[model samples]
Target: MARKAYSRRARVTGTLMLLVALGAAGCTGDPAAEDSPDAKPAGGEATTARAEPGKYQTLPQPCRAVETGTLDAMLPGLAQLDQEQRQKAYEGTSSVTYDSDRRTGCRWKVDSADAGHLLRIDFERVVSYSASVSDDARAQAVYGDRMKEAELPLPSDPREEQPERRADDSAKADRDEARATAPADDEAGQGASPETSEKPGKGKEKEAGKSEEPADETVDPSAPAEGLEPRLLRELADDAFIDDQLTTSSSGSGQRTVTVVFRTSNVIVTVEYEVQPKQVAEVPDSASMQEKARELAGLLAERLSDV
Candidate 1:
């Protein structure tokens, strides 16, 4: 009985030893590789991950963003400047900023016989600290707030109207047009009144200034040309809007400021063009001012693409 017991004990010990050895071998792995940055789960998901950074890491120098040739169109005073003054004008004054990487700006101002022009360009680089949100997303949020502040006209949605109602409205408009084309009985017997008729070149006079009393068909005396009013833009950048405001002082001097703001990726750009006419009666042309600002904004966007 003692010998049988000893043999059983020996068999149990050997089996236990074999199991421990196998377990130790299975647990064996390279400590260095396991801790390495490149080493990751073969089948399991990652514990944590960093998010993508913004596309723009640094901002461009604002002073040199606009070229001299472009400045000439935007700043008409450049045409009358002397050699030294022109060079100085091209070298715009840098705006005061503590951080160039995050924000930078340049300002140019010149006085001409017709008007005083001031151009300001600003660039902002947005960054996201969150490991989940991207830089572009942060920039988009900032731009949304800015758009809200601008209060530009939102595109009208035709689909929002009932289809049947829209059809009725279109029919009514057609009918109204037909009636307007038909001359009144008094006009048929005599002639159309000057106020009711619009000549070919008459549209040009209404552009910069208008003394005519506001009528149903006449454009506002203060507002810029018909299409150049403060509105959202579709062609300048990924997102952009132009704001034109004409301010008249007690002296009757008028200053029209055209501001163009746009965003590309993680960067936001702003172009402000102000024209204060020398004559109080001279209303700065909104179309021309907006055109110059839009052009400068486009050029800056292209310049940023290269960066």
Candidate 2:
């Protein structure tokens, strides 16, 4: 009985030792465990989590909420003419304001020539403003010259408050007369009277009027063909960097033309080349034009930054 009791005590001691060994193994932590194939390191710190490579850093000034009241104040007066007249002469359809750490400015979209033109105007105060017109020369012509002149009178009450009713009426009358005198296909074959034939100058005048009518009919003076793509322009303007391409092709001879504009906040670079008569032009030949465009874009971008 004594030998059996001692054997049971030894068995209990061995069991306790085994439990301690198991507990120690469970407590051990391996620092290299995360290095295993199945384990993933925290985001952004891992070698596989690098950002995609690209030119230009993120913009310093992001677009913010637009100021409609400021825009209204800045908008050129259209009160001199009727609504239809106003729509034809000016292109301030939509406006927005953005805030940057450095300054605040406004952007607007105007449709011209069935395309979009982006206009950005930066305001220093209620009385002072600066403007930038994008790549389109036609847009620049109207906005820079005509619209700029018109807006000079704004932020003030004009002494001549009367609407130009006579001007509007005369324009409408001229349009109607032009439409009436236009010749149809059937009318082209008809012979005129002896009196009409004698008065050749009068008939010529009528024919000239007919020819002019279509120009008036299709012309929306408010919107012109040289307008900018306002939204795209705004995006490009707001971005710290932009790389975009414009391609145009001629159907007559299967000729193609391409223009690329690459820009940064301080610089704009353009590359334009033509593929015509089934031949691509040499880069050296287009270098001057491209450089000129780049210079223009850079200057415009810098000016726009102020607004």
Candidate 3:
């Protein structure tokens, strides 16, 4: 009996030890199963630190990106200008010229108003003219040419697309034939005569009159025309101001030139200037220019209000 009791005790102890060993094995993974030295994190959570707010915000000046396309679109005849003239118009203290390469087929000059922070304008796809402007004396001599080259073209007149009337002899002949075939019916009796054989001809004439041509789509008289508005330009200039550091100003009789402060938190800033014809010229005895100016001004006003 004593030997049986001892055997039972030994069996219970062995069972308990086996359970504890299994539990430990389950809790601790094998050393071979551990993560490798070069193993990536469990998910795509980046180990790098996050960038601060406004880190990638654009500078608050007239940047190359904004001006380049706008200028090219505004001034189609820019490329034809001479290099000396081009340099004079675009030359500045922080200007850098890049020669044309395989990727970019045209030479370009990039001008910065303040370091690289404010007012970067790129005169691209230009003829190489750095040699002409290298000396101060040469630039002075060609100053007029430079100014002319720098001036951007105004937006094209939208009314130039008006259709012209055809003066072909065939149309005249057709009209003559129609007039000759018409009955000599008076206007008052023409509609009253139900028994008249000319009723079918009149119906055809009515159809022809109806089909002559549809009137053009009605344009909103109050709507502004294409191009940047002066008011919006002023607003943007106003927004570009930083802590009362800069002042806005205008020049020319019709306020043709506008100067504004430009700033950005990331870098230094400076003044940016723009020139526009204050009022489009009016040809004497013709209201076209006056009308156009009014139309353009309305457009400018509308754009400004929207902005």
Query: Could you say which candidate leads in lDDT?
Result: 1
> Which regions of candidate 2 are displaced past 4 Å?
1-4, 27-44, 52-84, 92-262, 265-300, 303-307
Descending-lDDT candidate ranking: 1, 2, 3
Task: Kindly report which residue stretches of model 1 are placed more than 4 angstroms away from their true locations once superposed.
Answer: 1-40, 43-50, 159-219
- Tens digits of per-residue lDDT, candidate 3, 241-268, equal 2111111234311212222222122221
- Candidate 2, residues 153-221, lDDT tens digits: the string is 233344454468657877999999976896532344456544434443666888888987856356432
Error of 2 at 180 (Å): 79
Give the Cα-based TM-score of candidate 3 against the true structure: 0.22
Best-to-worst ranking by TM-score: 1, 2, 3
What would the TM-scores of all predictions be? 0.69, 0.25, 0.22
Q: What is the lDDT of candidate 1?
A: 0.86
Report how far off residue 68 is in candidate 1 (Å). 1.0
Q: Candidate 3: worst 10 consecutive residues by lDDT?
A: 237-246
> In model 1, which residue pairs have backbone atoms overlapping below 3 Å?
none
Question: What number of clashing residue pairs does each candidate have, in the order they appear?
Answer: 0, 11, 1
Clashing pairs in 3: 224-299
